[model samples]
Target: MLREQGSAIRNTLDSVLSLSNQKAYPVWESVNSFALIKAAEAGLGITILPENLLLDSLLHKKLRLIELDGIDMENKMLAILHKDKNITQPLKIILDNISNVL
Candidate 1:
């Protein structure tokens, strides 16, 4: 399934799955994470999501993690800022907090 119409996830899947030569699977696309989880719980289909997002469901036994042997399913978070932009006090504080937590 897909999230938002122009999701980077779609491109990611295309690259990972060699989508050009493969037949398309039926998709249940949505922009909402809750909807996606509910659909998976109902056995509609499996989805790829960040481990953090699946913690609750996994703890409750509502979802299972299936590790694929050859898939590079790493997710990363990046913070970008323009070199010319000033780092305000508030922004620095926020960034520091996030850095500490991470």
Candidate 2:
């Protein structure tokens, strides 16, 4: 496994893999997305990353998507704020923009 350190997908990836019968593989973990992509391009191993991050490489055929059988690796972004906290005008506008875009 090629793992991205401190990535949100790490937890979900672990949970999904644990439920399967696949054997554990050695991991090359890094926090740098560029390094991860370089490693993958060099045929070191496969990794899971946001599609937007690798769009250019994918289009150039430098990397290819490896479909995982019976796995849903899709993820959604969530913006959380404390209910007790006050929402300032700027914050509200930012949140509204994000909500509208999404």
Candidate 3:
């Protein structure tokens, strides 16, 4: 979840509440890379983490991480420009080249 603190907490709570009705489980919180590794080492909970976070040494043998498609946000690196500036020929060519890859 690409959410700020409060929203992340709410989402985690909702997941915990839903799981509670079916089985006994532990609920965790939204945490940065270091905190999450510590939580896992303490045997407190599991989390949905991105692949990039696992490169840290704390994550090694500490977290039981999994990958899920369609669970993460899709971010596009866009170039925002003012409409008033008339795009020069060189700029137009560059934009066209970027669009091709996208």
Lowest lDDT block of 10, candidate 2:
1-10
Most TM-score-accurate candidate: 1
Best-first order by TM-score: 1, 2, 3
Comparing candidate 1 with candidate 2, which one achieves the higher lDDT? 2
Ranking of predictions according to lDDT: 2, 1, 3
lDDT tens digits, residues 44-93, model 2? 88878777778888999999987777788766788999989899999999
Instruction: Give per-residue lDDT, candidate 2, residue 102.
Output: 51
The lDDT values for all models are 0.72, 0.76, 0.55
The most accurate candidate by lDDT is 2
* lDDT tens readout by residue for model 1, 1-102: 555545665555656667446533637777777788778878889876666667889999999989878777554557799999899999999999878754
Displacement of residue 13 (Cα, Å) in model 3 is 13
| Candidate 2 TM-score versus the reference | 0.69
Total clashes in model 2, counting residue pairs 3 or more apart in sequence or in different chains: 0
TM-score of each: 0.73, 0.69, 0.37
- In candidate 3, stretches whose alpha carbon ends up further than 4 angstroms from where it belongs are 1-26, 57-59, 69-102
Per-residue CA lDDT of model 3 for 1-102, tens digit only, reads 222344443355445545546422335444454576566567765644444555553356655556554344333458889989899999999999988755
* Candidate 3 clash pair list: none
